[model samples]
Target: MKKTLLILIFLSCIVMANNLPELGDYSSSKISENEEIFIGRQILFQVNQSDSIIRDIEISDYLDLLGKRLINASTDPAKKIEFFIVNDSSINAFAMLGGVIGVHSGLFLASNTESELASVISHEIAHINQKHISRFLAQQERASYQSTFLMAVALLLARSNPQLASTTMAGASAGSVQGALDFTRENEKEADRVGIQTLNNAGFDVRGARDFFTTLKKANQFSGGAAPAFLQTHPITSNRISDIEDRLKDYPYKQRLGNQTFHYVKGKLKALLGDKSNTKNILEENIKNKIYINEAGERFALAYIYLMDNEFTKSQEQIQWLFDNEQSNPMLSQLYINYLIKTNKVTEAKKLYIQNLNFFPI
Candidate 1:
């Protein structure tokens, strides 16, 4: 599962980077910087120690790059944020005491655009910057730091092991339990305000955040089913919706950067987690009917599906076509190189691999 010892990377980056915010910066006084870092480290330790993290390097790097871009635009660029994807298929994400955020694979599949996903990350980054977790987790008189630490870690484990999460969270008293599960309403609003700015600074379509939330709201109301895991914690109230919409009006709309990278990654992720036959049928039908949000992404998924199915020639066809438009996309390059080797063009594959290795190292 990549098994990169996430904590080590987080610490090393923290040590190397400057301008990191103090724990007391906009946070409660109860938790010191060391204590917040310690809690974040423990949570990351559990994340790497667990077997549920996704093993795909592409997904891992895509998240890392996306997250870092957002972080660079946030209040704390040198915060050394760590990103990980859990294997669970729940449309949720959460932030903890430190600059730690985890995204569920289900969130990726559910998010139609890169901006939509980035909006969530932007919100989580705001939560971390506002020190919401440290303030909320440490301020409770009845809950000690140890108890709060376990509660935070339990949140990371919640997707992988609900029983363990429940048991670990039991250490905190009843009053703290609700705080552990959800942020305060005011905290949610603040996060949205700060996150929207972050999104704007990072050049994402600011409306992407609103679109995702609106879709979730409609889906929940129409289905009469429980809200997605994200909504369950980050409750989208009527006020929250109105506030977000009103906030969006502050910025004039314009053309945002193309989401080609987002589309490519999404296509790859869909191929990684989707049901093979069902996914293939959908992609083909989308192409035939031209009923796709991004035609390039659908074709990218088709190539991935074909390659995984060992249809080398068909995969080659898609790769050649994609080269015309996305010649420099690392994911596409990786797929093309793999296609070359699989089709007994190892010499050409090796040369191409070396040529692009330095540029798209991720």
Candidate 2:
């Protein structure tokens, strides 16, 4: 009876393999697409730790606007690029299965210009355009099938009282997990190639990809433990930077500067990063240099810094300026409330807090 049951199970496995869907065709189906998006959204939500939701929206809209322009310019117009700006300050961006692309807020600030931002977006889009996700999925399916076979055999053994099934299943699962991660390195390389082309095709500065990676390398060294989540998945390397430079030589594109959005976002991001002394130093320099794009951001930084430094009087003044002059930004408003409380103006702080909650109801 055991032999007969084993034979039946083997046959069933063979039948499943024969019916296994082609990755390309399977991914085309709506159900497959939805599953990918769902997974991407869940992963994004689970990892978010930022206190500012408004900042996320600001960057998300900016990236989407830029991404749309680039995606529209692609040779294959049917490819869609969906953008999300995550709250994490990590210098990372990720493209999940399907067209879902996410950028960490830190990535926005880390970039020096629009081209740098485009470099990251282009890389992610390249992943989708190259069908990297589908390829990875196909590889995963094979490993999963192998794992299932091993688990089935182990279950059969356990039924006979050996009780090794759980251990066997766990080992097989670990192998499958490692296989998925191993395949990601290949996917990243493919995306890097595609990203450069996307940048060139979209009329962005061709050197931007190399430059962004270079900056990220420095940032990784500095941040160490606080490194962005993106680096954890896509390891940076000197070879990769060299490869990007080599690829750019083949595409002799004209140098065109990026847009206003890049400057705006970059400035805002810097204000979020530093403490009072650091912010004041940067802000003073920016003001002296007449860098208006970052002016509002400098103000926001100064306001937050004063609040943190326990100068309630100065904090109140700065917060008031932000409240009066800046647009309805949630983070700036939250900063104001925080500043008010630090100053011992609890009554005023309470009112502002209530107002903030009303304006940005959770």
Candidate 3:
């Protein structure tokens, strides 16, 4: 069939990549490391200039540390990683050139544990580690003549390589491109395959990947057949779930302790975004009934919600709970400062802020 041939032609160059020993290399690419870095810089510049990027210091710092931890366990331990959280509520995350990974805030809220979140980061790292950059760029030039194939390639790479995607979409038919979108499921699968191993190496529970996929699948059912933004970008098929389950079988079953910071970050998003009343009730009930990820994080969320509601006394009570055990949390420190300033404690807030400069200097 015409469709089948087009898929084969477009993927011919990348097909043999499956049997390779290395996860592709910079030496074989026409785009040099410097060129890739420059491209990444431009893309990040565009992203930063956009209003959608979260400029929160606490969230950004946590993401940077979490991503770097996984990168240290990667095949290229010394590889530099830049991670950012977008302000969008959509469930999406992407990796691009120059070791850049951007995660949407909704994805952070959707993640249940540190390992689930790390699985997503690990998958993106694999995309860069596997050098989909060079292969995608090369495919763009080679497959340009066929409009449908080119469109499929661009759409497949849209989340990972948007600049190329924009250019490719301009000349192709949107109506026709859907047939060829499956061009890169192999690439996605490979990312998953490579990601879990790195995830395990990084000492995370690989089951987080499997559970996250199940979450996506369940979210899809109530989506009116439209799918989440994440599902659109990272298409999860039944086969992919089976593949993950099989890969998971290779690892011994053991629980990985969730990080307190991870729980705090998740709780932070819950309090700040979505339904405030619903989030407040959830946080309060979870804390009172002892049904929370980390009780400290739950109290932190309740404190944040109380602060936003101008319930300073109640907020301080929650902060005191966290203070009893964790007096050095960055997110809590910021929240406490905000609460202090709101209650006419500027002198004290400024003093505390100055004191934290040495430790929480982000």
The best candidate in terms of TM-score: 1
Model 2, 1-362: lDDT tens digits are 12333234334444543453444433222335554554444333422422332344655566777998778656555776666664445566666554666666677777776788888888777777776655555443333333333332332222211212223334443344333332266667777887777777788887888878777768868876554445555655667667777898998768574454455455555655545477667676776687754556666666555665676776677667756765666666666666666666699988988887889775
lDDT of each: 0.75, 0.59, 0.70
Ranking by TM-score: 1, 3, 2
How far in Å is the alpha carbon of 186 misplaced in model 1? 0.4
Clashing pairs in 3: none
Instruction: Estimate, for each residue in 169-262, the C-alpha lDDT of model 3 and write its tens digit.
Output: 4444433433323327887899898989989998999999998877776766866665666666666788988989999999999976667888
Q: What shift in Å separates residue 293 of candidate 3 from its native position after superposition?
A: 4.1
lDDT of 1 by residue, 1-362 (tens): 12233323333333432233333332334777877787677667666756667868877888998999999999888887888887666577878677789888878877877888999999999999999877765665532444455445445444233333455445433324544566789999999999999999999999988988866766568657866778877867899999999999998997976768778877887787758889999988998899988888888989988988999888877778788866478878888887888778999999999988798763
Q: Among all windows of ten consecutive residues in candidate 3, which has the lowest summed lDDT?
A: 143-152
Please provide TM-scores, in order, for all candidate models, with all chains considered together.
0.85, 0.58, 0.77
Least well predicted 10-residue stretch by lDDT in candidate 1 = 1-10
What is the C-alpha local distance difference test score of candidate 2? 0.59
TM-score of 2: 0.58
Query: Who is ahead in TM-score, 1 or 3?
Result: 1
